[model samples]
Target: MHMKFIGLLLAATLLLRCQPSSSVDPITTGPEPEPYRIVRDSIKTGTYLGIAIDEQAASVYPKIQALQATKGVSALNVVSNVFADLIALKERLPLYQYILLDQKSGTDSGVQITVEGKTVKSIYLNSGQQLTQWPEKQAVDSSVRVGDAISTLYDKLVAIRNIDRYTNKFEYISLMTKNLSADYDGGMSQSPQWYFGFSTGPNQMDQIQVHFRGGKVSKLYIDHYSKY
Candidate 1:
């Protein structure tokens, strides 16, 4: 009887050891996050009419000259010497402005390229009084450009997750378009300039304006201090 009991106990111990174990997986680390996704995915820079931001003045001048020669586009260079502030005047920081006229009455209705200290500062492209004209609505970047429908730009802007706080808000204002050519009698009409203001902190706001001509984007205005 004693031997049988010992045999039964040994058999039960062996059966318990043979049973499958309930597994508990070890802790694992997740994949690393990409730090540059926001910047990489965001619309940060713009290219206007073969000119880009931060391009050397020497190189850009030649291209502008070529455009003038080939396209019959008038180019004018002016230096801004007047400043309301005394310090600014004393500094003698002159802005080298290269204007591309659209055969309109005034330089205001033209593409203005501003450079400070041999660096291209800002680019403002707008259609002249004709509802369509020179500067030929070019790309601001791969994703956005002049001549694109305003709705398309809006859609692209809304889809950007970065800078949502600022990009989401927009203001629309009318820009005056006038043709001085005897037919129109210098008559002025209204076109829309959509403004989108972005701010990262107090006292500083970066702005972008999309000016429309004939219901399409004819102007792309980028601020020098803009991040987008």
Candidate 2:
């Protein structure tokens, strides 16, 4: 009986030794990383396209003028017509992946821009409001189709609005793609634009329009309705 008891004790001791140590540090994991972008707590009182125009225009617009001159275009015309495009395409301009607009009143707005090297590829504008007016509904062309861009935009909206906290406050409406006019004549074959709509309240919906050029978002429009 003593010999049997000794063998059992040895086996139990070996089993304990083979078991994982309770003191061993656990391997911890975190959420996926987000893209880099400039975020400001408040939008400057006097700013244009999220930049302080008074401080930046003199130094920045001049370079844009030079580029316009190369194309035999007048600075005034370019400034009036394609200033945003010029700023986005300019290599010298600072590149940003996202910009968060947090107002002093505690309201938050955000803009996400996708960039490839020095070129601005796409832009996403999110205003925390539900949309009521939809002027572009008639312009939608069902022939154009959107791929994963809609899904990406949906995920982005959820992240921006903290929709998980509201629990069924918003409902997915539709995702559509359309060919939009890029110029006055509508001659240029611009990339198809994606429109994602969501119903935020009873009989109220918000729409986000994303325009892509060369597989990159060239423009983003957020038509939101005030919750109040």
Candidate 3:
């Protein structure tokens, strides 16, 4: 009976050893959280133009106090020395543009002005998109060339999407001229525009559209499946 009991105990131990283990490998879970998703909440809040008046721009174009004299506008958006002459012919200019919305009257009005070295070169009142208010057409120079503009746009995207670390997650699809015309203004015009396209994946379902005009970003659009 003692031998039989010992044999039974040995058989039980073997059975236990043969049973499959429940422990799982720690590496089986999917890759670490995507870094871009960290800023997902901010991205969903509103449209991000990624426009900021930098130190150089601010130094060249100081804030205008007269804008507050207007009925509703209490402040102005001052952007200085944002663009440079490709030929290095002239100093960079500052841009004064502000938007004012009156909730009581449901009225909206704004002003856009371009200042060249302390002199107002152009002014547009109540203009939308500010396309019509772009400074007098100048030849596209190497200083603020298309390539430079593209780089700036890319940097802005990296900041806005918070994907600077995961830049590999995006693929630059193409940079094509949307409105390539030398006669844009009846003569050689500087307002040439291009559309830059980028996709988050090879599927090309999600895309980022960057519209560049006059060597500066004019508009930004994000096309994602979630939006639809």
Candidate 4:
């Protein structure tokens, strides 16, 4: 009886040992990584990249008119800064890019922004000046919509301007559609094709068309009054 009992105990001990000992080994994996451009606060986030792209092919008409009246060097369109002085951009010039400044000529419409020395930003204008072209809300198409129309307009505008000297850019035939038309109000600049004139006053329309197709905006137009 004692021998039988010992054998049974040994069997039970072996069975217990054979059972999978899983108290679940603790996982040592680390947490997942963060995204490229995530911003916690909705209001504090930036669209700097979007703004920069938009500025690439933007129209200087609205700002130029404002500057034309003031005859000032800088405005919503034209910006001049020192080669290294980013602090001078007092107010964040939203949707503007650096235009390479020309070392020699004080003004070269050929170049958007330029300075004798190198600029911290990619774009530059002549004489260390910079210009950021905002969308001509007035210039947007009223009929067709969808896709990236504003950027399209901006692309076409810059392509043309870049192809020719600054003088030619003012005259370069715009590929953009004149799908929507506003009667020439006449505060127009003497510059070529820039015939339409508008008040240098604040843009009253909540949103202006940036790009157009089939008589409508190509990209989503932000209705500043309403969240898009």
Show how many residue pairs clash in every candidate, following the order shown.
Answer: 1, 4, 4, 36
How do the residues 1-228 of candidate 2 rate in per-residue lDDT, one tens digit apiece?
A: 222222222233222322111111111133432222222232224442222322322232333234333432111111001111222322212222212222222222223233333333343323323222111132222111122133233333334334343222222111111111111112112323423233334333333333444443445454442222
Off by over 4 Å in 3: 1-192, 212-215, 225-228
Candidate 4 residues 145-177, lDDT tens each?
Answer: 122233243333344335333323333111111
Predicted structure with the largest lDDT when compared to the true one: 1
> Model 1 over residues 74-191: C-alpha lDDT tens digits?
3221111112222222112222122121222322333323232333334354321222222235233322332443334323323321333322121111111111111221111122
Query: For candidate 3, lDDT tens digit of each residue in 1-228?
Result: 222222222233222321111110011123332212111111222234332222121121121122123212122211111121122211111111111111222211222232322233333322223333222252233111212232232232234224343232222111111111111211111323211122234322222333334443445444442211
Question: Residue 156's C-alpha lDDT in candidate 1?
Answer: 32
On TM-score, the leading prediction is: 1
RMSD of each: 30.8, 25.6, 28.4, 29.4
Error of 3 at 172 (Å): 27
Off by over 4 Å in 2: 1-190, 225-228
* Residue runs of model 4 more than 4 Å from their true location after superposition: 1-110, 113-127, 130-207, 215-220, 223-228
Compute the lDDT of residue 127 as modeled in candidate 4.
Answer: 30
Report lDDT (CA) for all predictions: 0.28, 0.26, 0.23, 0.24
Candidate 1, position 195, lDDT:
28
